[model samples]
Target: MSETAPTPAPAPKRRSTFLRDLVIIVVAALLASFLVKAYLVRSFWIPSGSMENTLMINDRVLVNELVPKVAPLRRGDVIVFRDPGGWLGPGMGDDLVKRVIGLPGDTVACCDARGRLSVNGHAVDEPYVVLSRGSDRVVRDDFSVTVPAGALWVMGDNRYDSADSRVHGTVPEADVVGRAFVITWPAGRWSVLSRYGDEWDGVPAP
Candidate 1:
């Protein structure tokens, strides 16, 4: 009686190994991306022109959520955070991006003689403020406020159009989502987002 020819060796061992290895590679890649998104960095889409010139609408940005863990949040950090209040309409959205103008316990004011936002008595040179190209204007109405303990005063690069901390008040430090570190979309606009921290140097600590 002829046997069943060993049933074609029950499928090749090599084929099984190849499939298993492929699965492992795929799973490993998926896991790496998840970890990076969870702890290292996260990508966000700009929904408005609030950060115009510096960050335009639809520009995708990469925020380093790892920053607060690595270093203290400081002035000039371009950050994303949950809405402090009316800044975001009901059910419209929550996350907003702005440059930190005031740290906890710091005072933020607008348009010092040269019309730049000043933080804690230091007159910062704000070259990032963008006015419609031909306008060359930079004052966004005079206002002053002190950032309460454990809160941050944030503003957009496009001051006039942005509804930020100046509108809804300071965001709790805990509400900060991350520090935006790069603009990753629109090839022509791709560049590392820089913080004006150097200018904060020598500025008195709050």
Candidate 2:
């Protein structure tokens, strides 16, 4: 074969062409985020002090919108769920986040002689709860609830200040929209949310 000429290098892209490519890249990124928000995870605005000491009002968190499909719900997982029945105002549709205290068929009660919560007659130690003034081991209030089938009993970390499942009763497990996996706002407070792994993980499923 005859010697072939060296192939010429491709021409440089025009400035306008470079800009168009950048626009496409930005649009693709935006679309990816939009899809995540709609189908996988979404950011939520904390609207109240219900979960204080662990999550503050106005702090932001990312919720796995498809949690029900990914894994089974467990005790101590922080979950966000829609207003179950009268939990919200008439016609209002909103979600609330709280730690799961009881699973379906579990009996959750407050304050044993040592001031700890009991599940199925076994006392559970909660190191994250707010304490009574000057008493480090005290958990406030006295209430007992047996979670119904297909429901969950939830409570905020700020025991004395929250109006959670303790107030309106157990919420339908079907109403759980997602599990909050992280705090995304207030960079100083940014961190992954963790459940009571070694502490309560061994509790039998109801």
> Model-by-model lDDT, in order?
0.82, 0.84
Worst 10 residues of 2 by lDDT: 132-141
Question: Where does candidate 2 stray beyond 4 Å?
Answer: 1-28, 89-93, 134-139
Per-model TM-score versus the true fold: 0.83, 0.82
Error of 2 at 182 (Å): 0.8
Candidate 2: global Cα-lDDT? 0.84
Task: Give one clash count per candidate, in the order shown.
Answer: 0, 0
Candidate that scores best on TM-score: 1
